[model samples]
Target: MPQMSPLNWMSLYILFIFVFLIFNIINYFLFLYSPNQNKNFKKKILFNWKW
Candidate 1:
């Protein structure tokens, strides 16, 4: 197999990191901005249980 140059390897690494950061930021805001009812959907189910 042919060897990768240092710049190519570095750019790939940086791109992977940048994408990871962007995904996490998007997830964080989604969690933050989601409605309270949506977040507590499971809790509401348990609250109605008789046991």
Candidate 2:
């Protein structure tokens, strides 16, 4: 069996975290700037919250 060194594990963990954050940021921008999404989405969300 083979095992990764502690430094390799740490770097892998950091890379995973960086990728996760970048994915979230890209998703946020897509949602915020997409032309198909508009104030209607916000209004619908607020309306649903009222229930």
Candidate 3:
């Protein structure tokens, strides 16, 4: 059996955090600029009828 070094564990934790942040950033931008979201909103507004 082998024991992991503290430095190695710290590096792995940092890497995981970096990856998680990048994933969230990508998701934010994708959702923020997604044409489909805007399209759906516009369609609803354009087709919504008020009597």
Candidate 4:
């Protein structure tokens, strides 16, 4: 393996970090999971019965 200078190493690290962040962001949006929502949820009053 060729020896890399400090500047070269820094740039390589930055490049990899950016790539990792971008990949994670893409995956996060791709697999967006939402819990099942009830259509009538808004119609039901939570405080209908007061203790």
**What TM-scores do the predictions have?**
0.55, 0.55, 0.55, 0.57
Cα lDDT listed for each candidate: 0.81, 0.81, 0.80, 0.88
- Which ranges of candidate 4 are over 4 A from the true structure? 1-4, 37-51
User: What's the CA RMSD of model 4 in angstroms?
Assistant: 5.6
Residue-level lDDT of model 1, residues 1-51, one tens digit each, is 236687788999999999999999999987886445554455434565776
The list of candidate 3 runs beyond 4 A from truth reads 1-4, 33-51
Return the lDDT, model 4, position 24.
100
Better of 3 and 4 by lDDT: 4
Q: Compared with the true structure, what per-residue lDDT tens digits does model 2 show for residues 1-51?
A: 237687788999999999999999999988895456455554434456666
Estimate the lDDT of model 4. Answer: 0.88
Q: Per-residue CA lDDT of candidate 4, range 1-51, in tens?
A: 357687799999999999999999999999999999777665645785768
User: Model 2: clashing residue pairs?
Assistant: none
